[model samples]
Target: MMDALFITLQVILAVIAVYQFVFSLFGMYRKKKKAHFPATKSFAVLVAAHNEEQVVGALMENLKNLDYPKELYDVFVICDNCTDGTADIVREHGIQACVRTNTNLRGKGYAIEWMLKELWDMPRQYDAVVMFDADNLAAPNFLSEMNDDLSGGARVIQGYIDTKNPEDSWITAAYGISYWYINRLWQLSRHNVNMANFLGGTGMCFETKMLKEIGWGATSLVEDLEFTMRSVQKGIYPKFNYDAKVFDEKPLTFKASSRQRLRWMQGHFTVARRYFFPLLWQSIKERNLVKFDLALYSVNVYIVLLTFLMTAIMGIDAAVFNGPNIANIYGYLPLGLSFVAVGASILTFMAAMALEKVTFKKVYAYLILFPIYLISWYPITFYAFFTQNNKQWSHTEHTRVVRLEEVVQSKQV
Candidate 1:
């Protein structure tokens, strides 16, 4: 019975691993046909902020200087429950700042919903709505690329997310490495195979009519994910635009990163529980492969928990329990496969770094410790599962004030 149980767990994990591995194979081929379109779509750029006085000005400057025409896009900042000078800063840039003071209805999703209603009531009509966090620095060509994508009939779009302070600390470096890996292997790979692209909280765009039709109902901690699942149910797949880039500020310390990820996982658990069955049923009813893929994607945190549980059971049984003495190599299959998975992850990280032109010397120490950061997710997943009922939103403070020019110049070096 013991041997059989071990084998069962091993097989389950192996299947999940294989599923992810197969999808990753598609990431290597990222050649997308380009459609040339005139820049005609008008965009209402929305920035949601909670006391982001320090970095909001920089983002304002970045937005003001977008390579796209000035008449084509307008910027609006939603200052939600902020006691700081964020509104003043927006006014300083001559941009309209919308303030919201609802303590009960907080979080980015609620703020977005409020702003969307306001935009809908206003006289100015926009073709599409672009969302960004106040800490982000948009690429000069960000709006132009998004315009092209909108013209190509993509109702929702997610741009490439780049790191601003990758070399700030080990934690930031690890975050940068993780984002780079997922952007290429996960997002680009899914897009390559015609799968749906998940929306990053920042760098996301939605067509005005489509968003209104879907309704701004996603108000969870991870609104981007919640909205993505909601869109998938309606057969709306967000397109990934590699040419459009947005530089995001990463937490510089482990404590900050931990808080951020815990909130994310907890929100992930909430989303999974709420949407798992609905997505699976929709997929079967409609025979939509994208919905099926999303159903699996929704339970990614549970997969992590399962991995941790299996590793613990295998280790405890082999060392402390010592109940099974099968003496067969099959008992060690999980261990062998784990080592292979780690090796593959390292290779994936190296490849991602190379593609992003990150020098080994600059990030070698952080790269060495990346596995440790990855392993930390197990405990976080467990904690998040237990505390999944807590829907309180905690803010991750972003203080790195890097300019768009500085980021672009560093990449060119």
Candidate 2:
């Protein structure tokens, strides 16, 4: 019985680790296709602001200057519970603004839901809604690419995420690496096999009708993840548009990064609690492969935690419990499996850096520290789920105001 349990433990870790290691393989075959815009489709550009006075103006200016036809899209800013000049800035730009000062409704999820409802009551509506954080600068051709995707019959689409201040600090650099890993492994990978991709909160779009029917009811700390899973379960898979880019500012400090990541972990745990089993059931019942894929993706962190926990269990059993000695060649597969994950993460980080044009000389030292940062996720993921209360939203501040021209110039140099 003891030997059997030992082998089973290694097998479990081996399976999950191998899954993650091979996951990026899906994107290896993904090819970027040039966008061909058939016609200019109308869009409602929605900016969700929360005390973002420092950078909202720049974003509005960037949106106003999109290379696409100006008449086809209108910028609408949502000043939800702002104690700053966010609303005034929006009005100054001659764009429509909605100020919601209710202390009760907060977070981007609530703000977006409120704005969608308000837009629904208007005399006219848009063909699709594009969402962005106030600190994000749209690439000049963003809407043009999205227009092409929409014209090509993509109902839900997610634009690529680029960092405006990757060199601001080590924290931001780590964030940039994580973003690249997720963009390639999950978004681009899904795009490769014609699978549905997910929205990354910002740089994502949805058809007006889809939200109306669904009601944008994703009110959580990680509402973006919630909305993505909800949409996937409903047979709506968001496609990834590589040409449409939104450059967002990353947090420059560890406190802000922890706060943001904790919110994501907690929100992801909560959404998994609500939808994991149902998604699996629906996928099987309806023969939906996308839903099956998401069912796996939703609980991935938990799966990692479980695998890690088993490794610890093996260690404890060997040391204290006097079970099978994990250090022995008899049962070292768990350790080997773990190294597989670490190696994959390191390679993927470099791959992401290469794709984002990050120089090896600037980020090589940070790459050594990258695996350590990922290992920290285990504790954060656990803390988010087991010790939970006061689900009110908390957000990271984004004041970096790097413009597209500056980023382009920096890249050229």
Q: Against the true structure, candidate 2 has what lDDT?
A: 0.80
Tens-digit lDDT track of model 1 for 18-130: 78877876777668578868889999999999999999999999999999889989999999999999999999999999999999988999999999999999999999999
Question: Deviation in angstroms for 110 in model 2?
Answer: 0.9
The TM-score that candidate 1 achieves is 0.95
Clashing residue pairs for model 1:
none
lDDT of 2 by residue, 1-413 (tens): 75666567566666666665576778655585565865468889999999998999898888888998878899889988988888888899998878988788778998998898898888878889999999999999888888888788788899999778877777777777888777877678778888878778999888888888887988888788889888888788889987688898988887788888888887888888888899999999999888987887788767766756766777788789887654433344577765766677677767766765665344556666666667778777777777445477886787887778987776566
Candidate 1: misplaced stretches above 4 Å?
A: 1-6, 323-339
Model 2, C-alpha of 347: deviation from truth (Å) = 1.7
RMSD of candidate 2 to true structure, Å: 2.7
Off by over 4 Å in 2: 1-10, 29-35, 314-341
With a 3 Å backbone cut-off (N, CA, C), the pairs that clash in candidate 2 are none
